[model samples]
Target: MKGLRKTITTAAIGVLAVNSLVMGGFVSGAEIVPGSLQVKEFRYLDKELDRISLEKTGEPDGTRDGHLSLLIDAGEGTEIKSIVLKTADRGGTDTGHGIWTTWKEPSDIGKYLLAVEHDGKTLNKTFKETLGSFKGVNQFDLYASDNNSMKDGEYYYLEITTSAGVIKSDVTPFADADTSYAPVLIREFSWTDLTQDKIGSAAFGEDGSTDGHFKLKLAFAQKTKVLSVILRPTDEDGKAVSAGIWRTNRAGVGWLLGLVQGNKIINTEFNKDVTAPVGNFRGSVTLDLYATNNGSIKNGQHYVIEVETQFGTVISQPVEFGNKESIHTDSTVFPFKTISLKLNAKEAAVDEKQVKLDVAPFSFEGRTMVPLRFVSEAFGAKVDWDKKASKVTIAKDGSKIELVINRKQAVVNGAAVQLDAPAITRNNVTLVPVRFVSESLQMKVFFDEGEIFITDAKEQ
Candidate 1:
């Protein structure tokens, strides 16, 4: 019974109700009325196995012992004459067909006449009573030895031929009993120079120069195929830029290109129909981001890469492309600086300059908590405090961080992010988690022997 329950639950998850009418059929002298029959729920019951795998493997070795549980809803005032369940291969050839009658004789009103056929052989059976006999809801538990036993890669669907019209359910594939599901994982992602030499090649055309190239590495936990790879620009706070501001190209209305692996280009036309099975893939993708128009990628913008696979879609962390020096006319680069603080110490160092803190840093709940105003000011950011609301806001460059006292949620530029620990107020000084605040402001935090170091430089 436990195995039967698990099979019912697993099959219920893959049920999709998409009912449509069969077109191009007209009666000679009668006006056609649309049928109101719908397949409410469909479940594949395998008495031998406890679970069914939705992954598409090759055809099964042989047929399995299985049945089907179908729940149908016939609309009011519309009577269903007969119900047909059929199985077909991937190429639309009928493998099995079954027909059940609802209205026949006085004794057949409650008893259903079921007949199934497979390979020119017919099996007839009489079902006692249908479940849920009230209010047009009917449940059918169908069983057939050879006609119902389906192989992997075969599709099954239900069609209700009512007095009005014919209503067909969406075709669903039979599950493979051998394959288990596993999601794809993004192993590594970064900007690289793998495709730098081939910038102006015939593959890229003449207008496809980019400031940098993105290297994406993926690992397939199971057998899967790549669908698409997209690169989208984001803000400093990692929110995607609006679609109106997306960078376009002369190649197409949107930025679309083939991926490069070593020296070869795969998926040349962005066609997903002709993809092979992937194990571990590493490739480089370049986007043309320079134009004199308004929708081009900005100078100091950040971008993220999204890879869609057969298992699922995975997104990478945001990485910056250009800096402030490229955006502004002034070519002056901001000097990278490091700030060091010690636990329970009133003194700190900012690039050899000593500063005094009113409240010393301490450990709260295994997290390093530091004075909010002192640390934010040291990093050349402006801090504003609201006494009545007990809220603190830190702003630097284009990033804005808002934190409320005693709250575990913080907002970065308009997006809400969870904090490792809530901000606390001690002796009228606000203390926050150093790592969360530093990372939110686009800085890196490191811990040594007894001290904490914060830096604005790229990690080596």
Candidate 2:
């Protein structure tokens, strides 16, 4: 028994001596022992854990302490092939450990090692987290009922957190709609109220009927108060029609305020302060319209007009209005058989030089206004000029085209073609349609008055 004990003691001493020598060599930067192991990697075993409630009730009722996910990595020269999980608590009280973990297949997450020093000896554990190919959501949207419940606003929010970071989106709140009303009848003309005092008709309309254009003759009582006109056609429900108000001069000069909603018109209160002098001024006002509760304008249809006070809630009665033909022609006197004009050219010497052409009549303005057909034909387009409204339409291959003269712009097939010069009415003849100037040079044009309009359509 003594011999056996002695032999065991000697073997243990030899092993200890060798281990100590290796440790010393490594610490002193000398060569390492043969066949010594080295660590090579580190990583977290799980990329992400399921969302969990942090509120703890001491029972597994879908709530618990914040769970910790483990990170593992390998040290230099050694890969941690496996790991085991264990928990410790300094106090004896029972505390929650994370979900039970076991050795499993390494995941797509890169391999890494966890290291700890115990009595100057390094121990390593490997960690890897699972990863999967991401597939985008089929439908992802955030919506809000109201941003502000009391003030008619829109409000909503979305929140999300990922390994990359946390994210949030918000929408503000708003109020509800108010009551609405409409003027079913309107009329305006030079009038003296019960006082028989001369006053511009800021608000007037014939009562009890919705027919015939009620001419509005405005006589400004105050130059500071501009007249605002509104026109709407509505169903018995008081829903408004898509209608527009226009101001014109005795010379037929006019301005269009495109299809405007009556409610919004009242809400915005536009044109209530335009200055006009008190005088016997006669001008035509036309109101284009859409059906009540409808957003579309009826081509070549009747409309209603309503004029309102400059600084009051009073609305005019509805006025019946009509649409005159936008174009007319008088072939009785051939104004032009031959016409000639200059094109828009930057440099006369460049390839972009303007093309000048002459056609037959030579009768317009005695100076020979350019023929609409001749100019459009030069640019490979068929021309159609409306003599009544002074509108010119050009087309190529069955699709309508555009023409712009000086200050006039025309639409061909739903596209606006603007001009640099005003279309002239000379010698009882409409000189030129604007579309000729715009479409000829392959340039874009836009109209800016009270509103802006744009168009770009070319055949395939």
Candidate 3:
């Protein structure tokens, strides 16, 4: 038997029990990986080389003198350490009952051959051979691991030559093989160290934008690929809202993922963002995420971040939006953290040189509604009014936001945004919610003492 035990030892039997747990603790070894075991095709010639079976093996006629061979393939990630050939052993000295290796022809019926063809060359290998019985099941250990194990994507098979007895030795193949007896699979994954770093959002002009945008950083030791992102924004009372969460595309032409709903995302396509998580990293990804000031994304609400990777879904701690939300950090984070994005900046102190609006903004239903021209012009934004169309357009820094008179909706860069309040005319001034200029123009605005302080790249 070439040092191969005729029966499974206690340790080998132990695996059988543990594998049973995955498939209800009642299936076979094949259940270890669930149908990962199967026989492909086999062929054999009778004693006189007159009869052949180039298909699935059926019951032999117990005739003597023959040669047979089988071809086997394992599923991915499957490690075939050993295999058991099962056959019924009819009682009462079955006359033709016996088997041997086909080493030198029509005499041997037990010796198996293993080979791997690569680059037009074939390499022959050895296998531990054994005949065994387990749990009242007649099983032949046709092949077992020595230094040579049945790895996935390798060629392995058994060849049998009968001495009149080979016909009696019933050989069971994978097609009819029981999975409950199959071996376990070893799954492999591309290891990566991915983590979320500082998470902060500013509702003020702190980052040069008052419309309310948040910044988050993700760190990894190597270049990583982002599969998907899920955002869940809730108000003070914890109600779901749609927060427009997006990231700049590689082409820089536009943004990807225009919107996210109650943390649900329908866009599944993703790009590979190569990041260095181990060095003195200063480049951080800044997403302009904010509450649209609508009922769903009102300021002072809490939210969470959920992302999917190859391993599984990764979740972030609950974070509040608006104002400056505290971020989470790790000791492993790079010491030199800097603002790499030109769109983000630290808020400047209340300077004497301030771009104050001519008409002080007033509160409408708890919202600080300001005149579109004063707010836009104060921040270097060109304001255009179409008296014929009754539309007000505010263009600044590659962005164009338009609002219709007495309308509660505005179009930002061709994307429509619904508002909680409408633009109204007061004393010949087209007063609209501060959000139009803040969120739409991404210009941070702070209301203090009835004066609207406008800040942007110039001020920052």
Highest lDDT, which number? 1
Residue-level lDDT of model 2, residues 160-207, one tens digit each, is 222333222121122121210111112232111121111122222222
Candidate order by lDDT, decreasing, is 1, 3, 2
- Compute each candidate's TM-score over C-alphas: 0.30, 0.16, 0.24
How does residue 453 of candidate 2 score in lDDT? Answer: 12
N/CA/C clash count, model 2: 78
Write the number of the candidate with greater lDDT, choosing between 1 and 3: 1
Q: Model 3 compared with the native: what TM-score?
A: 0.24
Tens-place lDDT digits, model 3, residues 1-460: 0000101101111111111112111112221223343333232211111011111112111111122223222323233333322222222122222222212233445423322211111112223232211111011112221121111112222322121111112222212111111010111101111121112131111223223234444543222233333455645443445554432211111123222224532232223331101111112332333322223333455755433221122334445554343343333332111111011122221222323334455666545566677656655789988989889888877878788887867777787765546787776778876544554655333222233333332110
Task: Name the lDDT of candidate 2.
Answer: 0.24
Leading candidate by TM-score: 1
lDDT of 3 at 108: 45
